[model samples]
Target: MAEITLVEAVNQALAREMSDNKNVLVLGEDVGIDGGVFRATAGLLDKFGDERVLDTPLSETLIGGVSIGMAAQGLIPVAEIQFMGFACSTIDQILNHAARIRNRTRGRLTCPMVLRAPFGGGIRAPEHHSESTEALFAHIPGLRVVIPSSPERAYGLLLASIRNPDPVVFLEPKRIYRLVKQEVPDNGEALPLDVCFIIRPGNDVTIVTWGAMTHDSLVAADKLAEQGISAEVIDVATLKPLDIETISVSVEKTGRCVIVHEAPLSGGWGAEISARLAEHNLFNLLAPIKRVTGYDTVMPLFRLEDQYMPSTDRIVGAVNEVLKFE
Candidate 1:
């Protein structure tokens, strides 16, 4: 095992995959010579040559559109959008083509493309750079969405997404890319795509979250332990086909929940989790399920961003509120 940053792990994964599979290719802005803005693909171009590591023009639509075409023709395309926010510009192509080609062509065509996007805030980036748009992509029918909180998971899941026979949106949490380091093997072994991991075991309250918020939940859970509260922290690694069973099982035991995220509260992914919890197992709710998330407003600039995102105090407060009924 080796301790590596998330960025380095991803860079390793790309290099390893390209070495093993000649058909695997990467394309995105500044990906060739300059590497990515985050340096996730820093040395890939030097190793694989321009054909496999391409630097496309500043056009996300073309990136998404051409990726679908390349994948349909049997080349495994690992396309990157500089930021998660930038990918929104190509929603038309993603939803209309990359997402629907398998069913649209009645199995004659398969678009096995991985759309990599660096997302989330806390680095004080410009507007739209920190937005968590997983909910929007989850709403799409055929696209698979995955987020990795640790360096190891990032490498493994990304490799899995590239090999899977469907379009996947892999959201790499930029905040923890280099800040959070973990011991990951050099080989990019893939993870099972349809399940969540229980990072911490507990029986009091379940904290459901992903991406950057996973770290927030971990911090909050640690603090809650001081107050004699056991909050089970479950990471929804695969956001699209959510591991509903694992989540429900934890809630079934804990009997209380606090769905958290960096995105705004109203239509955020937390809302969907809460709705499903309320509908399927009302009796298990010890208190009304709580949600600590961003406000229902545009992601503000760095100055006021703190007020827009969830915090440890808010999570602690929610857990305290649930405990009051006990």
Candidate 2:
């Protein structure tokens, strides 16, 4: 029950799984000797030895191919891409082989692999270091895209992803990796996948978000509370196979909805959620759905990072806009 940050919680989950399951192997660039670029895999190599914790070449394609090969042959591989921006290089293997293996083999085989990467902007990282292109994987059929906003969720969701019998893209928000800490129990309990968690209960508006945006959304909720506005916050932990029912139910009660994300506005996952609400819960809304999101441009460098990312002011403003519909 030690207090740990999101990154440490991730390390705890990997260690627990690797210790409990001998077939679980960790592979990625600088994962072994270097303990990963963020040190999420720190100390794993020494505890599990080189055979279990392997250090691969700095090639995302090779890492994807090798993990898929290992998974098909009965080994459960948890592969890590150095950064979300670099994950595009491995999309071919992921979209083709890894995602289609179960259907291609007609249930004879399952791809139990977890692809982990740190994503989003805020840490003043250089180009190709910060990317929130989660929508790409979420659009792909048969792939489960999961993002955790807190240390507790990171621990549980990651364990669940590795145990899942399908390919899963586990994106970690690096900005919040060590921003907060929580006393997460190291009991090896895996949380449910494809579900949304209600972070706060309210009746005025439903605020939907995931990953690092959850932090700002919660902060906005608090600010709105001071002004006598009740905002319900929903953390869409499992982006793929989205739990729209949970969101729909919340929107029904709140009568207003505001979606938020760090990804650009055009094709962010927030659009899909907005579309679903309109399709199934159109009559229940009191106002048009609003989305507070990043601009449709490349993530800027350190100087402009703060402006590029959505802030509490934007979220509160969206809530206020929706509340005016009545």
- Report per-prediction Cα RMSD to one decimal: 1.0, 0.7
Specify the poorest-scoring 10-residue window by lDDT in model 2. 122-131
Per-residue lDDT of candidate 1, residues 1-326 (tens digit): 66999888888888889999999999999999988999988999889999999999999999999999999999999998999899988889899999999999999999999999999888899987998888999889998999988888888888888889999989999989888888888766888897898999998999999998888899999999998998899999998888888999999999998899998888888888998888876987778889999888889998988878888889899889987876
For all predicted structures, in order, the TM-scores are 0.98, 0.99
Q: What is the lDDT of residue 139 in candidate 2?
A: 95
How much does candidate 2 score in TM-score?
0.99
lDDT of 1: 0.90
* Model 2 lDDT per residue over 206-312, tens place: 99999999999999999999999999999999999899999999999989999999999998999999999999899999999999999999888879988999999
- Each prediction's Cα lDDT score? 0.90, 0.95
**Model 2, global lDDT:** 0.95
